[model samples]
Target chain A: MIRRLSQARERGIPEATVARLPLYLRALNGMAERGLATVSSEDLAVAAGVNSAKLRKDLSHLGSYGTRGVGYDVEYLIYQISRELGLTQDWAVAIVGVGNLGRALANYGGFVSRGFRVAALLDADPEVVGDHIAGLSVEHIDELEAVIRRRGVSIVVLATPAAAAQQVADRVIAAGVTSILNFAPVVLAVPEGVDIRKVDLSIELQILAFHEQRKTDRMTGGPAMAEEWPEAVDL
Target chain B: MIRRLSQARERGIPEATVARLPLYLRALNGMAERGLATVSSEDLAVAAGVNSAKLRKDLSHLGSYGTRGVGYDVEYLIYQISRELGLTQDWAVAIVGVGNLGRALANYGGFVSRGFRVAALLDADPEVVGDHIAGLSVEHIDELEAVIRRRGVSIVVLATPAAAAQQVADRVIAAGVTSILNFAPVVLAVPEGVDIRKVDLSIELQILAFHEQRKTDRMTGGPAMAEEWPEAVDL
Candidate 1:
């Protein structure tokens, strides 16, 4: 696995391609479950919702070129992609902020299915610190560094409120975590070499609203609603 | 607002620019709170995590050209971007599934602050239905169509399981929702006219793990761990 990953690093797969590998992996897993032996790039592309050309190009980064006529072998492709994504070994993950989102994430089956274990949960609230969620007792935030060290947590998920996110991020990074999945709304400033991925729910809705407004404006032959501040700006 | 939007539509902001507008808006909101009436491009870009050049280019899409030395009026920029994103009008959003994720979405305060109202919550399970979450009663899935129409829901959020996502999507689309924010781990097949954005938590973790693995491999000067199937493949 390490050899393949070293090769992957030497080849340097595009970040966009890295992001899509899980999608392809998910599609391939479904195919394997259905008793399929092989899959054409076209079928897999459709399953993953990408164009066939793009899918083939992405797979090429992993040094796997499917046989032209017979297509790609399903099991082999799953194994290859899984190895490339480092999913062959389970990763111990810790989530900070035991709010609704944190609890939801702990209970989410998707992470466990993909070789990720929710090893620890931490929150600052005294009332919430001892609560049991997803069969694990929530530990107080003060034990964050100890919990991470004791449980061998590698990646930390930040679902804390905006005010607490940065402080929690600082403490975790200082504890030697390099990878973070942030669900807080703030843009965290991390030191060099740390990987931070943010998931903001409101941002998604705002993007949808932009397109939805365009559709409504088209139907109405102009802006769908008048501005709250018509005289607010002259632009 | 209508005139500005019509002009904005004519200018046709890049989708990338539209996506980043919210970031700029959030940064500006923080500045506004801090009593910063105006901001230079460089400072604003730093806050929004983008370069000054890119920030200027994105703002240019809205026909905004900051003063050469003084920069932009923060309040005016906020209004313009909000209007462009259609956040000027409150959007009634209904969430389907009412699972842990669904409940999280319902209780999230960020949406309300950004002109999105969680007008209704619907779930298929009788046990979950009728429960109050975030001050709104969880309506039965049978009332999905009715609640959407009655509440004037223009956008739908799907937090359903992978199995039920498509069915709920089809129903909501048929009920006249043109926008959807899907958190399910499935590739939803929606019509071209509809806009669907997916947020897969597991995918994010997998991406982080890929990088985390790479970082570990680099530290170890090779693959961190040996392959489970050394003899499985010759490649």
Candidate 2:
């Protein structure tokens, strides 16, 4: 997915701008729900938690410049951003593991609100295979390829264990799914064209810890590195 | 979180390098588990799915330059990265919603493997409030501040509904929590010095949809934009 997002740079839109488009779309959707017809750049930026100047520059990439006085038409901008993000078309997604995270994702209200539909759920455990969840029966892992072919699932979400993640990913790619959203902790290696986006719960916590430590260091004098590295003062 | 990450620049490490530190640490840990004492930059880069030169530069920021012939000491590099990322100390994390997603987070093995501990599970629903999940009782939302103070929870994960996210965020901030990982679909507004990192499942799908749409458009001639914007030619 990193490679593909970088490829977005060649399409006249920067990768950073491609990421922010979803943020803009999400904000616009909220405004439309609130009966907002038009919004100024400053107002939209505030709602999106971004500065007004950066918001304007990002929108310019989509060729969307709001009227000076009227700002941007909320409905039109939603349509434009949605279209740009390919959310206007329905996408079939398959969940490849039926663990707790998979169950949460299957029932998550966010997916159906957009153009995504959880078409299938597969598991290796026979006890869970026939179980019902979120109005869909859990299919056996043996039927993964068949399910993808039958439902035309273009994307697969892997919520399997770290040990099972790579094997599941390989099978899905072989089944012709190009895009993957991985929740496992392992780093998956795929072919050149295949796109994989990993969501590691631990990594996010580590990042938060890094900043928290910095905040603590500021309150104290600095980090206590002398005990760990008594001989190294330069670092 | 954006502001805090950019602050890492003043500490001599780029925000990009700080982000990749976790990846390097994960790779090094795997090598240590396999009883490997040293690793070449090329080998570690392959495990982390990054280029060798980039990996070398990222480590250099930590004052860790691998020996020319012997390469990097696996256990020592792990300690350095862990110290740099503040993973050497434990962080008490309070999850503010007992939904399916929250339950998954509590049960996720990845958290305890690092420096994070799920100290509390909280929710507002009476039916779920007293239930035990992942061996911890789900406390009432009224106890949010008390739990934070009691458990020394410096990080809060908001898996609450979209409508309740902002209010919960306000309470956690008031409770002296500076770091937040929001899973709600809304964009939260936080005061300066508070760091927020959002993980939206739908946004990831939207990004994949954008790239998938581009692939489809390329297979065909071009995107069928004329029907949507007949008057606009330059876009």
Candidate 3:
């Protein structure tokens, strides 16, 4: 994992920049769909909801591709960001635990629109097994290693309950899947060389609540830490 | 939104720091659950998976709360972070799109533990409407404005299809939801003072794939942009 990171560092693209690349890519894709051939940094920034100068700085790190006045060629820029983000290659993904979240993930359009293919879905529940979702049949957890090996799934998505996350993570790691996107609300412990990214709805909501509190604080003009909830938002 | 932001600034907490407060809170909560008392910056940083120096800087923004020699009181730190994150007061949330994703969000335990109450669930589909999920009966989309008004739901979770996301966002915004956590694959346009945060699973997967590609590049010592697959991950 360190070696992999060093390679990104060697190219001088900060992880922050790498993360935002997808956001920009999405915005650019939208413009392309609208029949726009080129867009200025400012316009792209507005679409991507980022500062133009910051966007310029980020793109500069990738190499000077934007023009002085013509801005950036939309299709060419799309290829550049997609290539940089490794979307040019198809990646086989296995989603473990065919629960609500897993089912939603399977049906998500963004994955297919990009290069990610949900190759397999696995669940422990006998009731959920043998179910067809998004054109793929849900397999039992007993078929995990076999399915992973057979399907050549390099990435795993864990949508299991918190109690089962760690065990499933361990098993998937042993099955040779190196990357995992976790949604189980648990702190997963993976050995060296594994890459895990967590998307916790609770954490996201808490962050929003912090801002919501700030909104209330401004409205009441009281103490910043006041215990009162702001009145109904009429705005 | 600008007013609320200014209020947050008045309290001297940077938005970037505010974004990370939940991470520290999560790490601290995990430790508290394990019955830890005092934790050094390095220990806490490791648990939070952030740079220790950066972590110290972030905490310093909060004040001289963490004692240098003895580290920080785990419970106190949790309280500080929680209060800073506005988790002390319960915020009611209504989720639109009672699809698979909505069901998963309703079942998630982290929300309640972090002081977010899923007050209502709404959906537009005739089939999904009236179905019981995660103990809440899915309400028709017609009740959206009324429910938001009646239930005092401050946050809206958009899990609708891409085609319906923008329309749902418009209605919710009109109904007075200022904070939105969007799970749909579309970028929502909100009026000023309203906050919108998007979570795109496809983008996350693409990011992991970038690192995975880098890992493979290191192993092969070949060009980073190999046009062919490594062939182990079939399908």
Output the number of the TM-score-best candidate.
1
Give, for candidate 2 chain A, the lowest lDDT window spanning 10 residues.
Answer: A226-235
Weakest 10 consecutive residues, lDDT, candidate 3 chain A? A222-231
> What's chain A's TM-score in each predicted model?
0.90, 0.87, 0.87
Q: Return whichever of 1 and 2 wins on lDDT.
A: 1
Question: Considering every candidate listed, which one attains the maximal DockQ?
Answer: 1
Indicate the DockQ of the complex predicted as candidate 3. 0.31
Measured against the native two-chain assembly using Cα atoms, what DockQ does each of the candidate structures obtain, in the order listed? 0.32, 0.26, 0.31
Q: Candidate 2, which segments miss by more than 4 Å at Cα? A: A1-10, A221-235, B1-10, B220-235
From the highest lDDT down, the ranking of the candidates is: 1, 2, 3
Per-residue accuracy of model 1 over B152-213 as CA lDDT, tens digit each: 78889998889999999999999888899999999999998999998999999999999988
**By lDDT, is 1 or 3 better?**
1
Cα displacement (angstroms), candidate 3, residue B43, comes to: 4.3
Lowest lDDT block of 10, candidate 2 chain B: B226-235
Tens-digit per-residue lDDT, B192-230, candidate 2 = 888888888888888888887887777764432211211
State the C-alpha RMSD over the true interface residues for candidate 2, after superposing those residues. Answer: 11.1
Fill in the DockQ of model 2.
0.26
